[model samples]
Target: MIFDCLLTADAAWLGGRELAGPTAIGVREGEIGWIGPLPAAPDATHREHIEGVLLPGLIDYHVHAALIQPEKLLAAGVTTVMDLGWAPAEIWPLVERARHDPGLPRIHAAGPFLTAPGGYPSRQPWAPPLVAIEVDDPAAARRAVEALVAHRPATIKITLNSQAGPVVDDATLHAIVRAADAHGIPVTAHTQGSGQTRRAQLAGVRVLAHTPWTEILDDRLIADLARDTTIISTIDIHGWGEPSPDREIALQNLRRFHSAGGVVRYGTDLGNGPLPLGVNTREIAALTEAGLSPTEVLDAITGAPLRPGAPADVSVVPGDPIANPAVLGQAGAVLKGGQNVTDSDGGG
Candidate 1:
């Protein structure tokens, strides 16, 4: 491969283990070509040795891309982001920009939130028209999934919240899941209320957009979820600041979910409310409260490869092991597609 920049460092947590020795990674065509110990420098070779840690491109499983511009995400060390909910028409242009712009965050979108006729986002003041599709029947549910898939959505999102009014019925929810699965795309649902959670589980949804906090899940539900789907942690976005009822519910549900060995992903639900644009420290602290150690939390964010069809180059913070959960959001440094963007500012 034709290489451009070379970065050498002490030890980096490249997901699994701490890589030893001076490592050199080759970047070509905006992707990692080769990564290993530093090779002997050729005569007059050009490279930029980033001073701090090198982590895999951080992936925020949940985020609204519009909340934070792509440039800011890249500068802050987030290379890839999953826009959980947004107007596809408005977001398409930004996705195009990221696709071509080397200095911007790589974008993947869910198109919009699939909801019932009078669902949660329907009445929200901030909800964009292009961001939510209201489906009240099985046919409409199928159509919604097909529409999102037509836009080449990475996954499907369904809103099943009673608080928002007229929630999707079990048949419609199942139809959405079936349609998504038929196209080989997993369905992620914004499930709320005790009945809704149990219904979503029964429908074989691939992921719960957030931990079910409206009510505590029983052992049966947790075990069922642990075996079938991954739950994303938007725990910090629950209460924002004070100890409210929602926050308490989320914490309790997360505790049970983690104990059941359910797959968890670190997400801040950025742009949902008043959360920080970048990695939120409060999010990590909440994970710790749910029984995730620093290592487990790291694994959740900087974990293994996602989307086998679209592989992403991974690297991680080089040093200053995240002993304290409070500082987990302090991106030590970063390496994405073999390119070091954080330099030494990652604080080792």
Candidate 2:
């Protein structure tokens, strides 16, 4: 069958390794139909020659859309972003837009912040109305989870920020987790201050929205978390480029977390501060500092490989991304589900 588009790259990243290519990737019916060397490539209606490397679409595992525009993300080569907290009413339209528009990065949204009454973001001046669904007890927590499940989020987000305000009680936190689990949904938390990480861990949270930064985590807890939980690396949120004690503590904590084999996904708490909206080089630098090898770094920021039948989601990043980490922040071309969304000038 003649595919809709054929992409030939200088090289390609597949299965955690970079293969020297004249790699040919075919897209048809909004999915990848074939991947092989050019010598064995299938016929296509059109060919897009990539003078750069082809890699799976990058994913920023944590972001909040309240302050940033979605179009910028696609241009930055980020084809997907997980928005951890937003008012479902405020965020759902954007998520729906992304689903139908290749020009926007797909959003895997975690509906809203489920927190204690008057907790955290609700008190932050910048939070939109109803950005959180606050609960005071186990029963209330379950109901909030039920409400969120109806919206069909990628995961449920709970805020347990002792440093910011009153946190969800253990019973309530457990109820939220149990309720979400019953429906096959995982819980991701924004944990802060002492013991909140452990509380979330003990309550069966599956993902942490940010690496813990308020204090250094104990080794035993880090090891235990590594066995089951994944951490979203938002290390640059502390100060971006400036020095801060919080940044130092978070770096040390993440260093140990990595040593203990904790899974990390690249995330910049975009919109929270003056973070670079997409493909944050600062965040990548911090990840490298935390000891992630280039391949692992690529894996953390990108989705699965270009296997046949996968969504035709990929990007052309300039230069050898593994050799020159800075190139990962820029895109020459980007395709989301087989539709070229890169700028007309080929700037992603």
Candidate 3:
């Protein structure tokens, strides 16, 4: 059968974890229909031979999708983004738009942060009043979760930033986790301050929006966290464009966490600082410094495998990213749902 598009690469990163040499992939009906050796089909409607590495498009585990244009992400090889926090009224529309538009990165969002009264982001200048839901008690936490669940958030985001202000009490934190669990939704916490990481783990938070940077985590706690929670690496945000104590602490903690078999995913906290629109190389370098091997680093960003029946989202870069992570920032070609969003020259 004839396919809609065919992409052949000198080497393909299968699931971003292993390499397959001289591979070809066929796209049909917006899904990968075939993957094998080069020249699998000579009569496909469209075909392109990539003189580089082909891999699944990147997934940024944390970002504010509403604050940036999706096309920027698409151009940079990100095909999906998990938006950690935003106003539901404003973000849901972007998610819906992304779902229907193949040219945009798919957006999964957690609307409004659940925090204590007058807590963290509510007082931050960049965060508007509506960006945080203030909960003072278990009942309030339940109500807040219920309200957010109505919007069908991809996950629940809770602020445990005791350094900034009064944080959600343990009772309230537990309530939020329980409520989210009842709805089959995972909870992600922005853990900060001493012991906050341990608190989040105890409360059954499934993910940390950012790797805890304020304190060095003990090995025992790191092991425990590794057993269940997945940490999104927003280490570069601590430094912005320069190194700082926070960056140092984050790198140390992450190194220990990874050594103990912790799960780490790439996330830049894009809208919070001077982060790039997509594929922050600084974040990649930070993860490398934190002891992640090249393969692990690639797997962190390419969250899912490219297999038959998966969405036809792929990134073609001119060099082996495993050899040089910085090459990831330069996409030779990008495809979303079987359609070419950018060509080998990095132009749409």
Candidate 4:
């Protein structure tokens, strides 16, 4: 069959992790249809030979779509993003837009922050009123989960930031986890303050929106977190391109977490500070500093393979990103669902 677009690259990040010699990837109907060595005589409706590393589009495990436009992410080779929190009314439209527009990074969002009344983000001036759904009890927590499930959130977001304000009680947190589990959705928590990380782990939170930074986690607690939860690395958000106590503590905690075999996903908490709209090299560098090997860091950003039937998203960089993770921030070309989102003349 004639492919819609055929991309030939000097090297392809096979399955988004392993690098393979000269390769060609064919896209059909917005999905990968084939991948193999480039043909000596190519045959396709459209063909582009790229002299760079071709990889599956990167996935930023945490972001706030309302805070940044999709074009910025696409240009940075990020084809998919998981938005942790926003009002359902505000975020759903963006998710819907992603469905119809390949130019936008595919967005999977948690509708709003499920928290106790007057908790965390609700008290933050930047957050809108509807961004936090205040659930006071187990019943209210379950109902809130149900309401969020109706919007088909990628996961349920619960706020457990005692340092900021009132946190959801243990019982209510468990109820939210149980309700989310019943619906086959995982629960991620924004854990803060003393013992909040332990509480989230014990309550069965599957992911932490940010690495716990208020206090250095004990080895035993770190082990528990490693066994039970994946932590989204938003360490850079604590520093915002500058060094501070929070950044140091978060880096220390994350290093311990990584040493204990914890799963770390790439994220920047983009909207919380004056962070770049695209892939933050600082976030990548921070992950490396936290003890992630070069390959592991790439795996965190790539997330999955670019196999047949997967979304036709690809990022071509001028050089090997595994050698210098920062190179990822400057993509030479980016494609989402077989369509070119950005391309630079000099192979940026």
Candidate 5:
């Protein structure tokens, strides 16, 4: 196949193995057809060269798009994004509409945050009725899960923030988890305050929306979740404004979580406030400060900061890899669905 573009990077993060020498990746038919040393470019085809690095497109597992549109995500090097919480009736149809929108980040989302009656979002003015489900009983929890599954979410989001009003009981949480499991979907929860993480873990939650934000989880709690679940690092979002009590707790919790074998994922509560509309540098910095190396920090945003999927998208630093942790935040070439989406100039 004749490649429409040929990328040469001094270092290329090819599916997790960083190549040390010159490497060429060929894109044909909008997918990576070949990845090897540069052969002669097709005489009839045009080629674009990126001077720095090339890696897989970055993935943001949590973001709210109520404000930011989908196009910005692609321009920012995000090829796939998963919405943590949103209104099902409105967001579902919008997500369906976005399917035909070319080059938009592939969106896999949750219907809404399932919380207890008058939970966290219920008290916030911006928290609309459709943005979260307030379930106070096992039956209500089961109904919420069933309704959300019918809406067709990739996963179910539960809010276990006990500081705000009431959180769902273990029975109710288990009901939601069972209902979601019946449909083969996992549950991701926004857990905070005392025993919230433990409760979620015991109930078989697969992911935590934020690293515990009300207390430093003990070694036992960390090990429990590390053995089974993932914690989305919304570290930057927690410390957004002035230094507050919640931010301090979240920071401490994250430090402990990373210290344990617990997994971490890069997520910015993008639409929560004035956070960057795309891949967040603050988020990267926060994760790096929390103990992640340059590679591990990048991996958090890619697929396997904790698990495995593809290589975190590459960023070429002029200096040695060990010296330039900041370069991981620098956007580089992105490959999504194995196709080159942007070149050196940050355009296709």
Candidate 6:
């Protein structure tokens, strides 16, 4: 039997500082087929009166899938996540499984770190085998990216942690960016230690895995980065929930960048520490501290709106997140791709 599902909520957050009151949203074949005011809604085969503020599914811009259970993330309103660092051979299978399984959040992956022979993750004990490909020169860097094209990485990532062993040279970094551009892939970078953020930005890196925390950024440099790149906010990872100098430094840097019209994406460096499994309210609180208004914060976490033709991934929270940003902590009910995922305990 073919049936369409309708969900009615007291209010809905439509992103970009817009909110609609008393809404009716319908889903057909895993996509939003209809949406309007509750009084004007058409009949559906099944109707549910969800009792909460409705919003689009949240997205975690960075995570490592291998470290946690996928279902937990979906259960907590994180309908999508990006696997920023993992071997293509290992992460690709997980990505394929998530495409058809409601049990997992939709996955976007960047295969491995393109780094200098003895760079960052290569020496970190926690990084898995094959998690990084070392390149000695520009030719090797380009070739490594070309190889990843077959596996279809969502984007290319480079490591420039000068404090931890060697950094990828400028020629090699530019080669990585050029090759990724040839294939229409954007490049993300993890910058650490002194001057690395400036180096990454100058090299055409479109995304920063973590906001620069080691040193304060100059006004001109921060302005340029705001104009050219998107920064992933992994603010709480520096101290988990505790306050630290690094956390304070990053928050200040982000504060200025945001005021300068920078783009910030919410990404907890999940799996790096004892961070929250689902939506990290700590990260939310940190972003609030970094000067993002509740409305701007909503745009950062839930990158899209709950409109027609959008995937029917709904979030039912306690109150309007814009009014009370922390309400995103526990979604009372969630819909993933038009399916009411909260119906069960989400068991295997």
Q: Candidate 4 residues 5-76, lDDT tens each?
A: 888888877744457888988888989888888764246799988778998899999999998776678778
> What is the full ranking by TM-score, best candidate first?
2, 6, 4, 3, 1, 5
Model 6 TM-score, all chains together: 0.96
Task: Give the Å error, residue 292, model 1.
Answer: 1.4
lDDT string for model 2 (49-127, tens) is 8778888888999988756887788888888999999987779888887787767888889877999998998888988
Q: Candidate 2: which stretches are off by over 4 Å?
A: 343-348
- Name model 3 segments beyond 4 Å from true: 15-18, 39-43, 343-348
Clashes of each: 9, 1, 0, 0, 0, 0
Give every collision pair in model 2. 75-348
lDDT of 3 by residue, 128-221 (tens): 6498999999999999999988888999999999999999889999999999999999999999999999999999998999989999998889
Q: What global local distance difference test value does model 5 have?
A: 0.71
Error of model 6, residue 102, in angstroms:
0.5
lDDT of each: 0.72, 0.87, 0.87, 0.86, 0.71, 0.89
**Which residue pairs collide, candidate 6?**
none
How are the candidates ranked when ordered by lDDT, highest leading?
Answer: 6, 3, 2, 4, 1, 5
Candidate closer to the true structure by lDDT (higher is better), 2 or 6: 6
Cα TM-score per model = 0.88, 0.96, 0.94, 0.94, 0.84, 0.96
lDDT of model 2 at residue 259?
84
Across 1-348, the per-residue lDDT of candidate 5 in tens digits comes to 666656566656544434345666665545555666555434226565667655556778888766577667765677778888887766787677555454566777897888888887767788766788889899998888888877789889988877777887778999999999999999998887788888888999989888777777887887777777888888777657447677677777777777877788889878887787776777777787778776776677777321123322333333333345455456655555444446323333
- Per residue, candidate 1 scores C-alpha lDDT tens digits across 151-182 of 77878888888866778888898899899999
